[model samples]
Every structure is written in C-alpha cells, then in structure tokens.
Target: MKRVLTTLSAALLVIACENSKGPELTGDKPPETAGDTSEGDSETGPDPDDPPVVTSAGPTTEGETDTGTTGDTTCSFVCDTTGGTGPDIQCDNWGQDCPDGQKCAAYANDGGFSWNALKCVPADAAGGEVGDPCTVEGNGVSGIDSCAFGSMCWAVDPESGQGVCVALCTGSPEAAQCAPAGTTCVVANEGVLNLCLPQCDPLLQNCESGDLCLPNPLDQSAFVCILDASGESGTTFDPCEYGNACDAGFVCQDPIFASECDPGAKGCCLPYCDLSDPECPGANQDCLAWFEAGMAPPGYENVGYCGIPQG
Candidate 1:
C-alpha cells in the first residue's frame, strides 16, 4: 500500500532542489563509495568534508559537517554545466520531503556529496556504531561524527531563516555495511514491487537492504513498502465488471472492484437478483428490491462478483 513519489515528483519528498539554478561542475573520477570515504589526493578535489559553496541551493542541513562521503555505490555526480536541474538531491518543493529509502543533503556541482559526504554504510557499519559521527571533511567542535543516510538534517532554508534538513540523501540504506552478508536491508518494498509501488513505511513495513519506508499511491491514508511476497499469501484482489450473472437481488456498482450491493438493474448494470425462487424468474424481476422486503437470505453478502451466466 505504498507509492513513491516519482523521481520527477521533487515536491513529494525533501525540498525540491532541482529547479535551483547555479554554476555546474564536472570532473573525471568514479563516484564516492557509500557512507565511507576512500583516500584521495587533495588535488582530486577536497574530500566531501570540505564545505564547498553550492552555487544554487545550499546544503540540506546547517552546520552540516563537511566530512566523509555520501551517495550509494552506483550513485555518482556529474557537473551539469547546462544547469538543467539543481542537484541529484532535487525535489519538487520543500514540503515533499525525501523519499523513504533516500535522504536529503546539500549536494553541489563540486562532487562533495559523493567524495566528501558520508559514505553509504549499513546501519551497523563502522563496527556497530549506530550514532557515531564520522567527519566527512569540515571542522567541528565535536569530533564524534553523527549522521547517516536518510537521517534528518538542517540546512538553511533560503526562504526561511530557520535551518531545515528535514531529511538527508545518502546511498541506499540496504547498501549500508550494518547488515550482515547475504542479508540485505532495504526499504519495505525494495524488490519486485519497486516499479508497481514506490516508498515504504517503516511503521508498517520493514525495509530490507536498499529499501526505505514510503506512502501508498492508492490511498495516502497508510504507509507501506515493497517486500518479497514469496512467503506471503498469493491472493490478489480483483473487481467485478458489468453484464455478469448473479444469484439474485444484487447489482454491480461503482468502485466496481470492491464489489458492493446494487439493487437497481439500470445504467450498465450486472446480474444480482436471486433466480432460485420461482416468483422472481421474469426478465423484469428486481432481485434486491424483493430480497430486501424479506424474501431472500436472512443475512447475505456476496463476497464474490456476479456468477457465470447459466443461460
């Protein structure tokens, strides 16, 4: 029951950084590793830890330590001199927030997010250091690094003076080193349902490797994530259509898939009247009208759609 905001729906998650216009940066180098940083020459570009001034929007969080690496194994940064979108951390608006599996951070053309930002380590990466802070690059009063993928951040809101990193963008959560071998930690629905559904809710679903909790598209009322259904019941829900046969006294109606009781056999109606009784045999016979008047099953609820046409 979860739907992810499309990569295009920047407003759905963290602040939309896509539209921000700024100078672009492009360099030749493999993107940074997840959560952890690899050694590099200072000329290779300062480690992501250095607080490079983002030409467009600033960092996702204020006091964001210019330290460590960011992004996932495959996620990389390319300087867009054309200035099409702001940054990969792009979002539609400030209210959309970041997607479940992903986080929001101040990314720049300088490639700091990947090279200097925190590496995408597992939740338990760094030897079970769940909250230990690792310096990506910038100096800070506390030597104890404290940030992770998807964790909240506080960047200065250009619109509002208050800082807000509501969310951060890092490599895939599952890619983090915290999880054990052969066991991937992802958002709720990270597998087969990735295309059909987006996002998962941690409260309702347990994200596996590479997965994060998100909301549902059908109804935002609840949150869910995609997961392996191999162990789950294979049952699926289908709706009823028009012109199907019924036992007696019912009709098909709107939200047709859910199946509801309809007595009127008008307006693209389906069979629902009871024919077992001899009195309701003619074509004009109204099944539900008669049944409701104390003529059929005491308490009947047709769980299934209209039955096959016997005639």
Candidate 2:
C-alpha cells in the first residue's frame, strides 16, 4: 500500500517548532540565549568579559563537519549509529553521514520541514520485536528506543502504562507477518503504518470467545480485536480505564483527543455508528460528530458516535 505521511495536528506543529534543534527522540529544545550587549563594547575593540559570538556553518554540507561555538563553548557534530551524543557532539545528517546498510529515519516531531536532525539507524531495524514492552525515555532529545525494523510500538492502554510492539505491514492481508498463525494485517492508520492484528468478522460477532471485532476509529474498513465490554453492568454512560475497557459494542473515548490517553482515566465507552446508516439503541441517543473532519482517510466529518443529542 502507498505510505501516506501522517498529518501534523496543531499540538504536533508546536512540538515540531519546539524540537527543531534535534531529533524528537531526544526531545531537546534549543537553549535560550542571553540578550545582546553591544552597548558596553568600545569603538576600537571587543569587551574583555563578554561572550564571543558563535555562528553555525549553516545547514551541514556534504562530507564537511559542522561546528557551533560561543565564547569558550564549542560543539562538534558527530554521527554514531549506536545512539546518544556527548560533549561537543551532535547527531549527523542521516542522508550524508550514515554508513552502508543504514538509513536516516526521523521519529515523532513533524511539521512542514523534512526533519530537524537525522539519526543513523539500521536500514532494517525497527528497534524491538513483537510483544516486547515498548517505551521511549530521556525526553526524546538524545536518542530513543524504537521497535524492530518492521514494527512499531503502540500504547495498548495508557492507564495501565502498557504498550505492545506490533509489526508494520502493507494493507494487503497476504503481506502480513503476524505470529501465532491466523492474525491479519489491519489498517491501524490507513495510508500510514498498518498493524498485524487478530482477525474477526464484526458482522458475525464471532471473536475468540472473550474478544469482540470492532471497527477502528481511524479506519472503519479495518477491525481490531478487543475485550468484550458487553458484560459490564452500568448505566448508559460510565468512565473507563482503557480505550477498549467499555462493554462490548462500546469504545472508551478520551476527554482529550490525543494520540495516547492520560494515565488512569481514559474517557467513557460510547457506542459508535456508521454515518451511512446511523443507529442508536437507546432513547434520546443520536449520532454525534466524534472525530473532527479530515482527520483520517474517509474524513473526520464522516465519522461519528451514538450519544445523547445536546441541546
């Protein structure tokens, strides 16, 4: 399938600008510089205590080392595939500095620009394998722990501080490389990274006993296997701990629309519907706009959930 670059939301745009100095894994922001002090300089020469002006060599040129310095402070740009930067060292431009069998890949921080800084990573390494506990630490500034060559680590439940590493695959089911036999590659994020998940026909409601096949919020064409929420006894609405914690046929919606929910409190599990044939099983329930318009492939305006109609 064609790879579609993920769109940057307003929050992500702000992060991109804030992290323009380096890769998103390091989460490093540009340091604040002191105000100019030209008033104290003599007409004949320079000040004895003032810091020296430092200039960048501009964007790095091919095969040339780039350096930045201020006063006695000096930093050199270096490329190391292993990870991390040291005193006077910065990451190298992946395109220009990476060795053979390696490619420069950008993580997280995304905006109009290509990438702020490049990391030399194995051309085929995703960082971790499937079922591994995936996480990124150190504010994402220096380096990051990523999945293996053909996988991505996604948060399974924010509240539980749990995540799973899943293999990345094309939209074609035949190309899926999921383990344990029958799982298929589902379009977790259409045009972006597809994930290998257990297969089930939602219409038939025949899942692996305790699981339910539900349409994904990002892609209706694909379904995900989640714990059945139908057995939970509650009113029409109830708070949830995880995105899939609600009773069967309901999805836990976060109060804040984020790529990952905050720990402890996800939102309420609500019934979702197909806009093409909207339906609600309870009184005063109506299909309301869930995801915003144009957030995904079919457009956010076309996606909705069954809920109480607001006045």
RMSD of each: 21.4, 19.4
lDDT of 1 by residue, 1-311 (tens): 11111110000111112221111111100111111121331221112211111122234553222212211212223222122233332431212244553322333334332211111122212221222323322311111123444332122223432221112212332222213222222111001000112233322234432222222222222222221111111111112121111111222122221223232321112333333432322243333221112322332221112222121
The candidate that wins on TM-score is 2
Off by over 4 Å in 1: 1-107, 111-128, 133-136, 139-213, 216-311
Q: What TM-score do all the candidates reach, one by one?
A: 0.19, 0.33
Candidate 1 yields a Cα-based lDDT of 0.22
lDDT (CA) per prediction: 0.22, 0.33
Candidate 2 deviant stretches above 4 angstroms? 1-106, 110-127, 137-143, 156-162, 171-182, 188-190, 200-213, 216-222, 225-248, 251-280, 283-311
